[model samples]
Target: MRLPTLRRTRTVEPGIVTGTARLDRRTKRLVGRLRPGDIAIIDHVDLDRVAADSLVAVGVAAVLNAKPSVSGRYPNLGPEVLIEAGIPLLDDLGETVFQAVREGANVRIDGNTVLLDGEPVAHGVRQDAETVAKAMADAREGLSVQLEAFAANTMEYLKQERDLLFDGVGVPEVETRIGGRHCLIVVRGYDYKADLDVLRPYIREYKPVLIGVDGGADALVEAGYTPDMIIGDMDSVTDDVLRCGAEVIVHAYPDGRAPGLARVQQLGLSAVTFPAAATSEDLAMLLADEKGASLLVAVGTHATLVEFLDKGRGGMASTFLTRLKVGGKLVDAKGVSRLYRQNISGSSLLLLVLSAVAAMASAVAVSTVGKAYLGVASEWWDNLVFQIGQLLGRLF
Candidate 1:
């Protein structure tokens, strides 16, 4: 019986992710407070690339979404970004997860289930690279339907904002004198940092009136430049940027409800309100055009259809119409950076210097007066070399 003793084999389970839960319905606001190793619980449906990028930037342990990350809604780019960054994404955990899980509570994710104190609180489908790819492929099939909705929304926006769009009726006057000067409008969109870096020469030469919209103001400040004007709903821009001495313009609702005005007032900063139905990005362009800017250069603005959809709002329709209205004077910063690269390369510059030196030396050798000057220079060099040789010989 003692000789019959045997050992049983045990299979190893997959790794369980544990972290402090941080919940917010708004992904943007939640990201501000997220610390590394914290689990972000959000309700963002068809999460956009910007939000995903923010989450990845914050280095969250995992993402637990209450809604579908990809709802077959025109190939939203957020979920893929999270997965590509190697962040764990648990999708569609339902709204009850908000009730079951308290903020700041330590939680564990085992497989597809969320655990609080070793008890399952919520469950969802764990997403991987394969799942995200499949979802994106399915989402592409629904693009036509989304396009139709976008077109209808565009028409509605046109009807509502005809006066402001055509006549610039509600645009506020700013203290910054933009008349006849090139205006640079910045939005905190895709590849903004790279675009701003390449435009340094243009910024120095043209000295465009810099305008930052919402979080774009922070972008400008981060890039080592001061904004001449800051415009937005004031939700995202920091208090320090508001006090950066830029002329502040608040984008208000059509009904005159300026929610961001109170925050600006609390900071003791004076800002003019432009009450319109358009987004802050559109409002900035409208103000620049109305104020008689000679050229409008846009940076980090949504230019493509997918980008517009990624905004996840009906207001993006306003952007499409805004582009059409300001197309004549508008230029994308990416396009400008591409077309305007440094004409002089270092190798070519060195070659040019050598060519000039050769030409001067040849002229000096051929001319009588130049020959006399060269002889004097050669004698001086010979005397210097003789002095150096005598000094070296004495030292040795």
Candidate 2:
């Protein structure tokens, strides 16, 4: 297939772009410090799996995508981010894309032409997108692997700057009837936001205490719910929510001091610093169970070796270990939007009934006393009216 060439609209190192870097470990490890003309080799991506929003924020030129950015239910949002950033991105050649392109394929991009080992790959890839979609579908698993590799590499890149995810507070198992458990939803990726929107109704109905891990707070507010707690390292989360009234839990390593907490403290907000090795999601569950919460509902929690490793760390050794710590007390809401069937909008029904009562009382008061309320205070009139309203509302 005729591939598109990368136009150097953005400054990047050319010859140094290694094609085999499905993992962005060394690439992003040197993100802000890269001198202009650095070519970045990215793993795979399809439409459904274009994560790595942070990489796009920094300047990287000429990406050789190792996966389909969009495949299955996932969306390829990463390329779009790259395009906006004026980064030149190219598609790989089938199995050969993987087999021939080992770790360190010398990638050369001039204008729209991309040459890897003297073979032209992509250049000015303007065509009907339907064909592009079919190509992406054809390259599904390969692409997913590529994207996942990049994510895995990204964690390695991040560790050079700082270590995020933790091992978690040590607790064998938690048993608590803490009814109306305050739930904290955590998400590092964008896919979980869609699921969060789906569960908004049920969460409100149960009135679970809502806690967000950094960006999850914005995710909740975007879904029209206010957060009661916010936790995380505070790297990706916004300042407004960081200053929000919700309780802020700064995730610290086993040692007791945390950089995220330090930032929060500088803002003069009260922060409870907790030491753990698991991700903030672990802390969320631990906090709920430790605080005597009834049930802990987790959203976008991580599972599997790939996900845990992609998050960077010694795997989710801490999260896996922590799961043993609070597994029974936690409900993984990864697919909650798909599995949970919601019925009866709780808050809406409450508002509807409140409006109806307000209208009826206004009518009664206006007709009898020219006031907004019936004013049957401490009298037989008020008691009788209230009883009748309650009886009729319950009956019909």
Candidate 3:
């Protein structure tokens, strides 16, 4: 096979948003110092709440997609937003591109475009809409790929400390060791809140070792559940949650440039740092297996190809590999909520039926025994009939 290219062909900077896009209050306030035509480099972009019309109204020239929606992952909707706004979008290029070339680089993509890095790379490319669409498709698949890279990096770090960490901690298998025991992972995605509501009773009942991957910790606390442990790079989590009484584990690459650790340390909270390549979600499962959580119930997790790529990730080799390592204890709660029906419990129904039967029997017996009691029973019976009639009237 031919060697892969290190430099991307497209003229793009990973996180740069150029033009007159009206930033959200958060964004506007953040780079408030920035003037019109200045580039905005954002970390993650949500498809929902993307103000396409507003960005177009501001008259931005182009947007740099830092968080590329993978081939089939969650809808980034940035491209559609920019395209509809008549702004060109250069995707998947990040700080590396900017670091590679000093001074600002502007793209001119009307008919075709050219670039001047240290030297020229390519020029006069075809403006094939189909090709651009395909790139967007590939971009959507990037989420899963990025997740795998994270897991792989994490595994390498874990391996270095494996002898020090794994063998000493966990016990022999109790309910099957694959997903691990001492920890439980909760992911907040899709309709996870609704699913967790259904699982709240079960969680209160079983109280499996709790591990929240970043934002899941907040979700746990919001639902009246306590997290025993928390894991993730630490982005997207609130400072309040970082101080929450759980033992925090900060996931980082072996390179040691952990952005979240600073906040954790700044709060003076003691945390165990695990350097691994997998996403916090993967690491949570792996840590559970390492700690020996009996069952791993995942709520609102993204398992499909589309989900993986939406994060601008590559193929999900490591995630698949991690699942193979601990798929047994892993249960997707999406189906659990959908498959089970909710209603009054059997005991409640039985008690209600017995009460009705006893009422009827008491009325009949009292009526049969004596006239005075019969008069009382007749009144009770009439009241019951009237109540039932009113209930039926309302229901019908």
lDDT: which candidate is best? 1
Regions of candidate 1 where Cα sits further than 4 Å from its true position: 1-15, 335-381, 384-396
Better of 2 and 3 by lDDT: 2
Question: What order do you get sorting by TM-score, best first?
Answer: 1, 3, 2
lDDT of 2 by residue, 286-333 (tens): 667666676677776676554553444453445665566567667777
| Model 3, C-alpha of 208: deviation from truth (Å) | 1.5
Clashes of each: 0, 47, 55
lDDT, candidates in the order shown? 0.89, 0.57, 0.55
Per-residue lDDT tens digits for candidate 3, residues 1-396, read: 012223222334642222322222233222322333533333344432123333333444444434442234444444565565445545444444334333345433333222333243222223124545675666656656555665675466456545424453322122223342434467755556668888867776776777778777877887777777778877756678778778788877755667788889999987767765556787777777765467778876656544444333432334555666668778877656677758899999999999999998788777756567778878999999999999999999
Candidate 2 lDDT at 370 equals: 45
State the displacement of the C-alpha of residue 123, model 2, in Å, after optimal TM-score superposition.
Answer: 15
Q: Pick the candidate with the highest TM-score.
A: 1
Q: Rank the candidates by lDDT, best first.
A: 1, 2, 3
Off by over 4 Å in 3: 1-183, 314-316, 341-396
